[model samples]
Target: MLKLVVNNDLHVNKKDTITCKNSCDLFDEITGECSINQGVDIDSPYEAARCGFFIHRDSMSVPEIKDHTHFKFSLMDDIDDDLLDDQEIFHQLVGKSIYKEEYTYPLKPDFSSYRDDAKWFVSPCGSYGCWIVNHYKKPLSIPKSKDVAERGWNNRVYKSPIPLHDHQSALPISSKMAWLIDEDGFGQYALLVNGKISSISAPKPINWKRH
Candidate 1:
């Protein structure tokens, strides 16, 4: 499951029992009181990436806004050496699959200015996907398209229940370069571009809502 290590010491288990370092007043400006064992949930993506734990939203409690906190998360299965090299471990932990797609387009025209020239690829997770604009020398920009209605737009829509595809895209740049389009066209996923794993976008709540 997910394990939280704070300051390389205190271990926060059971969300309800998690407490802050000082007192509630310390986090008064924040969303909720910060107390040890106060019971706060972690983001699914962040949890999966850090602890390799797959926690369902239904099983999670409300999250608190904390700052200047140092925590270390580890996955129970990630301790194994064999699984370390495989990205699948992280994918399975996060409940996402690997997505790769490749296509050729005209290079003479300025395709970067037009969104239609972009090529979309579905991620293994099926929750999110990404698009690549070969002419731009960068990935495509599309909104998240998880919803069927939203998918109607030019954004790449991820098919629910996951799909089987042999499409693979080339980076022409780095070996780790891979673009993933989520079911929603609102976001894109890539590996270590300019020392960053993925691009940042407005955080989407566990469910659809305007925060």
Candidate 2:
């Protein structure tokens, strides 16, 4: 299963027990019986209660890369209408001009192609951006860890390439900010200025190898 490490502290195994915030039925449909606080398993109950949950996409299943041109991109924190309606804040964070690029799959990809494995960058609009690499490639491998205690799924794994010390200034006004580095340190996934996770599936199981 996918292993998620946050700030090099919290570790969670990706499993059915994990829950999502924006993707939850209650958050989306309002009338749905589903609740956001159900079935969550974080190591620390205090952190779990405060951190809540987030949906981390694992794959992209569009018929063709061309079809993804208009895919919506937004920050996970902007799910509420009250937050999204802040046009001034959105523009300040995402900017105005943006670019787009098409990518052909590097390796033959199955129908379950994922974007995290491909080369792409976020746009200024905080929506979709350009694909710097081939789009046809399959998604990157899930991160793994030797420590069982650190071998769990987590939503924070969706955040990677985090802002460095110099980039901290952008954090306050930034519209998007999320990055995840697999346990193996081979792959990376980042959120758009808006907050969309690159993939569709939840974190996958990590393939741990005994030393």
**lDDT, candidate 2, at 193:** 32
Give per-residue CA lDDT, model 2, range 1-211, as digits (tens).
9998656634544443333432222222332222223244333334333431232233111111111222333433324557446753333233221211432221211112134543434533333323222222344433233222223243322222321111121222122322334444322233233323433212444553333
lDDT of 1 by residue, 149-198 (tens): 23322233232222122222222222322333342333322332212222
Number of residue pairs clashing in candidate 2, backbone atoms closer than 3 angstroms, sequence gap of 3 or more or interchain: 31
Q: Candidate 1 regions off by >4 Å? A: 1-78, 83-174, 192-202, 205-211
Q: What is the C-alpha RMSD of each candidate to the true structure, in Å?
A: 17.4, 17.9
Ten-residue segment with the worst summed lDDT in candidate 1?
105-114
In angstroms, how far off is 147's CA in candidate 1? 21
Judged by whole-model lDDT over C-alpha atoms, candidate 1 comes out at 0.30
Candidate 2, TM-score vs. the true structure? 0.19
The all-Cα superposition gives candidate 2 an RMSD in Å to the true structure of: 17.9
Model 2, C-alpha of 34: deviation from truth (Å): 11
